[model samples]
Target: MSITKSYSRPLDFKNGRIEMSYGAGGRAMAQLITDLFAAAFDNPYLAQGNDGALLPMATGRLVMSTDSHVVSPLFFAGGDIGCLSVHGTINDVAMMGAQPLYLSAAFILEEGFRFADLKRIVDSMAKAAFDAGVPIVTGDTKVVEQGKGDGVFITTTAVGVVRDGITLSGDRAQPGDKILLSGTIGDHGMAVLSQREGLSFDAPIVSDTAALHALVAAMLDCGASLRVLRDPTRGGLATTLNEIAKQSGVGMLLNESSIPINQPVEAACEFLGLDPLYVANEGKLVAICAAEDAERLLDVMRAHPQAKEAAMIGEVREDAHGFVQMTTKMGGRRIVDWLAGEQLPRIC
Candidate 1:
């Protein structure tokens, strides 16, 4: 008699969760992949049943990126591991001004992982990849001891085709350029925190985890003269901006009032003693363009659904100290300095 067969149907995945046998290299493991992960992320690359995906590519410089998703509480308000993994890898490639074409995912499961939950994550991943117009080609599966691994962890590798004359990098930002933010900050982190800790709000918050290539392409199409493009992931907008400022050896001065922040998110941060600047965001981006092209660029961003809240919040300038300063809403200037301590680690 099959031990699993004795269990109840419909799988009480909400509570009855992961186990070691799920990750073990055996019949159960194969069944789990075939029925769940593979089903959700299926494509010719992943369908090949191989160790790695073999793919053809264009001649231009290829953009490749890899990222791992291991957010606590695998499922959260408005998003989960499945779509997050796809968005993470795709955004990494998009940061390079590349058109992401394909993805490969690897899953690490603790022994007792629940089949029903796995199915949900895989389905979510597939929908994201498919909707983003990128297919996951190949992948790997591994099992860890019951206690050694989290419920599940996913790592994804993406390959993209970079358009000619669209080179962008953190080091490419320059003084006198206009700094534009894609949209409001801190929503993703707030949403995740609220869901994990059972907090509720009058206005529900949702993680902004999403793919950014389409938005980037739209901006590029406008010929707004982009010098640099970056997605604010871990450490949020503050960290990413600091990295660019330091890399470009310049300073950033901002009109804080111009930056957008959801009122609910701002309120939550005040309650939690968190700064909205350093909080994590998966769907937001920072763009540095010529000062003359700022308005056109903002227009391009606002035209998109994801960037309806976008705004030009700051300007890069020459500074010996390489400091990032912002004018507060109350008309006081303060250093929007780099985060001294990790806020919300494992945020991405």
Candidate 2:
């Protein structure tokens, strides 16, 4: 399983730009795959060099999820699109209470994109996969003409395994269930927004993008009666809660003061006339469990580094209307509705 090396000069990464020939299925494409993608995402499955990866069969139920990342600013304060693609798909699989195993990535590169930038993104993806103990076992690359595409768009697919007797789903939520939030919200959306709009704050806001399988494993091992797990992503906590509420045919009551948000992000949302609840988040998750096991799950969640700021934010209630309501700090109640439209486009 070896790639044929070219005898000609190596790629001019510093000054060269992607050309159409790179995706023409010729020697240039082979060399690009060998020198760049395969080298960084080196693994036995990928090294096999077949049309598709040969994966081992698992005994448990399998879960698969795919995500496409098109964040406007490819590179931001804490992360770029490369790592974001990996983390986003991994989190999706983990939300099903499964152990992630492998990933497949496909990249659409603009013809004039810089080689140096592509290399940086590929390396970031490699590091993220390595740190998460998952491998990019298969992938495809294509180049689009200039002006036909953004700098790059990455689509990643993840597969995971879940043992028997451990089931989680949005419809599993029931009355008297406690809702828990992993940590602070709006960091990712605000980070991207600040960079795109050239707005600076007293303290820099960085995207909270990270793999959360480890944090999920801790909660599962604690023997808590968990019923639902969801990462509040594009629609933020408000929209995500509404989704779960509709799925389970129930309602939610949240305590405004209980939800955690970074001070800088709060300020940015205020100045920009945006509600943090509808803002996107890439690294935060929401969990629901029986009211009796709420404290136990919260203890284990707080013990994990990814969820140190975890808090019990709300509770599920029996309501045929399937509404999500919140209690503000001023002792007023209001409905937490779904996002009306695109609050921030391409924020991921």
Candidate 3:
């Protein structure tokens, strides 16, 4: 599409609302991309204005991950759907012990959505990418008829590179490996739940939504002895550990007292009749490494602000049944199974 005549007016970002034509392939669409997304996520790659970004290849193994964000309320205690979208996809790549390089975001905006709100989300996404040292190289936007879609939905795709000889996977966990958690769990789930349900606590709970690449890099700097790295997200810590157990053909034994759960989170879970073990976390990670290197890795992890609350919560064990058992504070042991059902839906 070519435009011979200059446009007369600029998009009224502060007072305007999204329109269907802004998503159609025409001057309106191009203007929206240029005035909104491009301005927010400015970079040489996105400046190309092409159908797809042309990224230069670099040495090392390539890692790519994609995630869709549908968090309700759009805004939350510590984050919104925008930054959440960036962090979620970046964490996925970081879980593989890769250094995130670039990102691409796509928006499914509902027609009549407020332009101010859209700008806020886009700006947040751009800031997240900038803070993480990654760029949104390419993106697409579409508008769905009003009431056909929610306020907005964002899908982010991230690409990263892992150095040669540095491999991490869920199946890499083995018997006698130590289990480590980056920090307290259930913060993200509870934060979102509180906002969605209008539940208030003595102290406000904030979502632990953050990118974990730097922490993963610090762990890798310690050594390649790191067996597996996973961010416990949707199903929370219990389901994540179960998955690792089944993947590595190993069972797990956890120390109930050692598993760190913030008092507020615990209280919220108790009141809500939810298990913190099964509540989702956005910023925390579960690392399984050789028993000998566990302390060493923990030292590296604790040195970072994100992992100051890191703890050796459990150990991988030899069990054909692949059960995840936790020794309770009450001097009893019980199963920590996968989340029974949807505890919190549309929680991101």
TM-scores vs. true structure, each candidate: 0.92, 0.97, 0.97
Write model 2 residue lDDT over 5-63, tens digit each, in one string.
54776888999999999989998998899899999999999999999999999889999
Candidate 1 yields a Cα-based lDDT of: 0.86
Among all windows of ten consecutive residues in candidate 1, which has the lowest summed lDDT? 5-14
Model 1 quality (TM-score)? 0.92
Name the candidate, 1 or 3, with the larger lDDT value. 3
Top of the candidates by TM-score: 2
Name the lDDT value of residue 269 in candidate 1. 93
Count clashing pairs, candidate 2.
0
Q: Which candidate model has the greater TM-score, 1 or 2? A: 2
Candidate 1 Cα deviation (angstroms), residue 75: 1.2
Instruction: Give residue 79's lDDT in candidate 1 (0 to 100).
Output: 88
Q: Candidate 2 or 3, higher lDDT?
A: 2
The alpha-carbon lDDT assigned to residue 291 of candidate 3 equals 95
Off by over 4 Å in 1: 1-18, 198-203
lDDT of candidate 1 over 54-83, digit per residue (tens): 788576789999999888778877789889
What TM-score should be assigned to candidate 2?
Answer: 0.97
lDDT at 222 for candidate 2?
94
Error of 2 at 203 (Å): 4.7
